[model samples]
Target chain A: MRYDIRFSGSGGQGIITAGILLAQAAAIKAGKNAVQSQSYGPEARGGASKAEVIISDDEINYPKIISPDIVISLTQEAYNKYAVDLKDEAVIIVDNTLVHEYKQDGHKVYAVPITASVKELLGSAVSANIATLGVVNEICKIMEHQWLLDVVISNFPERAAENNTKAYNLGIDLAKKVME
Target chain B: MEKKRERKFLQGNDAVALGALYAGCKFYAGYPITPSTEVAERLAAWLPKNGGRFIQMEDEISAMAAVIGASLAGKKSLTATSGPGMSLKLENLGYGYMAEVPCVVLNVMRGGPSTGTPTGPGQADIMQARWGTHGDHPCIALTPSTVYEQFSQTVRAFNLAEKYRMPVIILSDEIIGHMREAIEVPLEGELEVIEREKPACAIDEYKPYDNSVLVPKMASFGQGYRYHVTGLNHDEYGFPTNSAKLIGLQEERLIKKVEENYDDIVQVEHFMCEDAEHIIFAFGSSARASKDAVLNLRKKGVKAGLLKPLTIWPFPDREISEYASKVKDITVVELSVGQSVREVSRAAGGRCNIKHIYKVDSKPISPVDIEKAVEG
Candidate 1:
């Protein structure tokens, strides 16, 4: 079976990077077929940007996320824009600190204060997408933690690897706490 | 292979550069154009390390000329550009075609007539890649629907160009060029690389345009062979000759060189066409979506199938013809508003109903669009 996921956020929130990481980790590191694609306005940032990733064991014919089985919305705009299109039992992930208003739309909603936690743990809000890399990994479990961590950290500078790791671990812990 | 294979998540453009490198492409002269700029970027970074040459030309015209010049000087050369740049490069491209210059021109397509959409995707260049150049000339163009195919087809492009002693176009689209996919990079020396045939005879007897044979043995510039290479119709020694008989022979030989090898040059992938009632004709990125639509239609008891052409310029007429005759109807899917559909209709020869599932707003032709066409 194919698993479709969308990671949505304002541009420069690293949503594209996260989607690339997921697809790369699944395809290159884990030896699967994966496709990641996105479309956004010509804006440099702050637009309703979104990245979609589809991973399957077999050849992926339709490379788009078909009725996203999992959605990761890092901004209010992203959440509001995409939440309505989730699959019947889709797992919806959102940054609780950013997406304040969300109607329970049949899909299970997992809210984490991703921005707040990333800022506290990593001392930077820019890496909030990296932190949610951990949250999405924990919630979706599409790839192993170590592979996903490697894929995410490798995209960043070598100097910031330790803080990103700490933030990711914190995200995993926060996800566990929310589940309980 | 002494070197181990390297696996990486790479865009198709990256693979195109690497593929040229594998095919012994020693020179790249290209302008930066969207969807295809990464090809120049990757070659810039990798070519120096591999002892190859990369030059950013002032424009696509010079880029195409530079590639031809470098190839004439005995280097495996290439240049890549997109739609508008391709339009600019066509004159020089036809020059290379006429001169029988072996080089690769990668056209990573985007919407265009005149800078239509910089960031959007389009297969509008399908016919352009084949007929953009003003004259009737034989050229090879290959399209890859996947990243792996991009690498393989890029290598094939260089091989065919050298083998045919003519220009080859790698007609990649924006979606394939920019999309990242995991591919196992072939080890150095793992793939078969074909270089141009150097003259076996003495330098005194070498002729740049020898219509005596199908593909004349080219003597690279400064190879101690005194010969002329020109865009004008040239005689056996490559001197410009307006002789009616000789010019006609040169033109016919150029076309014959490719047309005679039609079976070898034409390539297509037939997916579940044995019992297919509906055959969908597509190439490049559109074929990916069509493949899925075929599968879905099969599940719905439609017996749908896909005929994907990897070698697009030669048009794969034979395979398309055979299938079009048997299938109840044929649907041509493309990002452009009916460029390839016309070719499919012509190749089908009214044997079957030819439908077009075309998109021209620069949006990708989704499977639903193709599926709807099949249903209709």
Candidate 2:
């Protein structure tokens, strides 16, 4: 399957890193080919940020995600801006606390309480992106959750390895408990 | 047979650094610039530990100068920067051009007239890259569209720079510089590496600027072979010359060295253009989208194709004309308002109908844009 996913948020929320780790999981651990590209406004720290990942079983010619199969927005600005370009059957994932308003008219929508879940489960929202990754993995099935864990541990700092792994598992639990 | 290697996911900038290291690059001096600072950052992290030197120069001009100095001292050297920095580097780039110092300069382009959009992607430097420096001199520039090409092309850039004893520019935009993708890269020893030829003649017989063989063999300063190297027009013995014959000879050889080997240096990838009518000529990020546009058009019962120039400079005019001769229409898609389209028009030479699909708002030209342009 060719899955085109976009992770949109304000910078420093690690959305770009999230997209990169996801592609690494698909390509390195899942044995699928993937391409991840990102763009940010001039004000890199607080500006609107977007990272696109395309994972395919076959060769990927276009390395960009023009018409997204899935859109995960962690901010109202990101959600409102990117919602119009979603695929007809796209799965829209949003952080309920941050993105209070969303329009997912033609497709499956999951308003995940990503910030609150990370706060309750991990004791801090620092790894909020990792927790959101778990929610997306559970719904989209882009790659195995185990593969995501492996990517986070290998790519992230050694000290945060244990907590990040816990963060991912907590996300999976949240996804199953709430979205089910 | 070439030994195959395992594939790994890597960012484009990291791939360039790895390729430089694998190609025996031992010196890196650069000023930080957006979309390109990662190239220097990666080199800084790995270069020193692997028997290389990484220096952060005060500015782009100093960075270019340091790379030239290091290369002349017989080390494979590289320097990376973005649009404004590249502009600041034009004088020294011209110095490297005239002095014929073997080095690689990476311009990981971001949008800019003067810091237009630092993090945004644009192909605005196509003309600046080829003509940024004063006066006319032939340049060798390569644009890699994928992470695999980013790695392999950087190695190729080193090989070309050393073989010709001139600076080679790796003109990568933000799209390829920052994108992360899975690439099958051969290990250090697996890739074929080329080193600059050392002079075999006696110390007294050496002529650093000798026009006899076009690319005269060079010996580093400490190697005991002493010779003069001035930016002014020089003679066979590297002495400044006012004689018209010597000036003409020096200018001719500087351009001829790369131009004569154009066949070997120029490379392009054709996507289903063998028997197509509408040809989309693209490079860098535009080529990636154009490839998808070509595939989509074929599925729509249209005979659309693409020609992606991996080697951007020297223009690959012969091949562009060869394929353009049979095509009914040619569309040049580039990120700039219009830069690469000029080269396409010049190469197509009025044999076919030429059209332009350009975007200069710092937004990437998606495949849908190209498809719509072709359908219209």
DockQ of candidate 2, scored on C-alphas against the true complex (2 decimals): 0.82
Per-residue lDDT of A1-180 in model 2, one digit per residue for the tens?
899999999888889989999999999899898999987876758767889999999888777777899999988988877765778889999888799887656689988888887888768888989988898998887777888889899987899998888888877887787666
Model 1 residue A4 CA deviation in Å = 0.5
Candidate 1: Cα lDDT at B281: 90
Which candidate number maximizes TM-score? 2
Compute the DockQ of candidate 1: 0.67
**Candidate 2 overall lDDT versus native:** 0.88
User: Residue B338 of candidate 2: its Cα lDDT?
Assistant: 82
Pairs in steric clash, model 2: none
Q: Per-prediction TM-score, please?
A: 0.95, 0.97
- lDDT for each candidate structure: 0.87, 0.88
Off by over 4 Å in 2: B1-4
